[model samples]
Target: MADEKPDFEVPVGLFEDFEDLKAQVARLTAQLQTLTEGAGEEADEASADDVTAGAEEADRGDAPEDEWQYPPFILLLDPPQYDDELRALTEWVEGVLVPGYLAEPSSDARWCHLWFEHPVAVARLHALWLAWQELTDPASCGYTGPSVWHRDHLDPSMRELRGSSGPFAGCTKGEHQIDHRIPGLVPSAWRQNDA
Candidate 1:
């Protein structure tokens, strides 16, 4: 095994070039750190009005880098960087999401088109979709795939979306009928109760 040839080949002079680039990066990083530290000290001397003005920029959409509107998993909005992201999400929703949720009519979960517009629903859906994609991917061999899908993604999202104390609490109140009901959707029995 010791005499076996390695799979990769490295150019003779590439090592020195890598070392040179590494040193340059370290030097530039140190310079940037010093500049930022100095700028922070100057910022502390600003008047109260100036600090308040800076905060207004955040509300005005001028400072969104640190205050992005959507989570990182949301690839469809904020200018729609990934073109295929929406397509993939749509396909999954149509193919898996609808059927899975509707399979159990008694499950508290039902299809609501307006959920696409709700902020909380959109965020959790995007997270769950991303995790489902990763776990089903052929190249994803990590042990964390299923764990993340169930623990970090699905459980919390479902709890937030359909738990008794969740957003749908009032929507699902006393509406058990061996069938799912959309949030805020009134069935005939609901009207009868008011009589």
Candidate 2:
């Protein structure tokens, strides 16, 4: 008998709860790390007000010039940043997007397990994730944010990402195209002139 994948049904709301818990845990961990580091510093150098202000700034999602910026475009990031962002993107795609939205794939609708290897797919999915983060944040977008996200971002992104002529075109539901190649662009006129 062929091995079949187990089908475990997950409640839709559970993903959201999990995400919230993760965010909370991350925030607490960061705070703990900051406090621990501060403890090591000369006590007089780090004032209570300074710590409080830094915490408040973090709570407000404010960052100094050197801090990591959000909604980073995958293609534009440096290698280390790209790897970190790609890992997070993969988690979001596999853990949340696919589980919640992607339907059983067909000839018309497709998905590639190696989507991250496809540059176009990576760019598109990164954009979608960036929008998701912005729209889903209660501080940035209020109660109606999720609705706006679905209407303005999710629908179009998903359609394009899974469309028959999209990045995963040659891939199928049951199999990934190992030799999938991105179509080449026209040779640069400048390079031709140089030649």
Give all candidate RMSDs, comma-separated.
12.8, 14.9
Error of 2 at 173 (Å): 2.7
For model 2, residues 49-99, the per-residue Cα lDDT tens digits are: 998999999999799875557665788777898999999999999998999
lDDT of 1: 0.59
Tens digits of per-residue lDDT for model 1, 1-195: 999987998985586456556656775787798779868787668899978887898678585463335335563354454335555666777688777653442346643444554445666777789678766542332434565577777777776776554444444333423223456855653124434
Candidate 1's displacement at residue 103, Å, is 3.8
Which pairs clash (backbone N, Cα, C closer than 3 Å) in model 2? none
| Residue 143 local lDDT, model 1 | 36
lDDT of 2 at 114: 90
List residue ranges in candidate 1 displaced over 4 A: 1-72, 79-87, 101-111, 142-144, 169-195
Query: In candidate 1, how many Å is residue 127 off?
Result: 0.9
- Candidates in order have lDDT scores of 0.59, 0.82
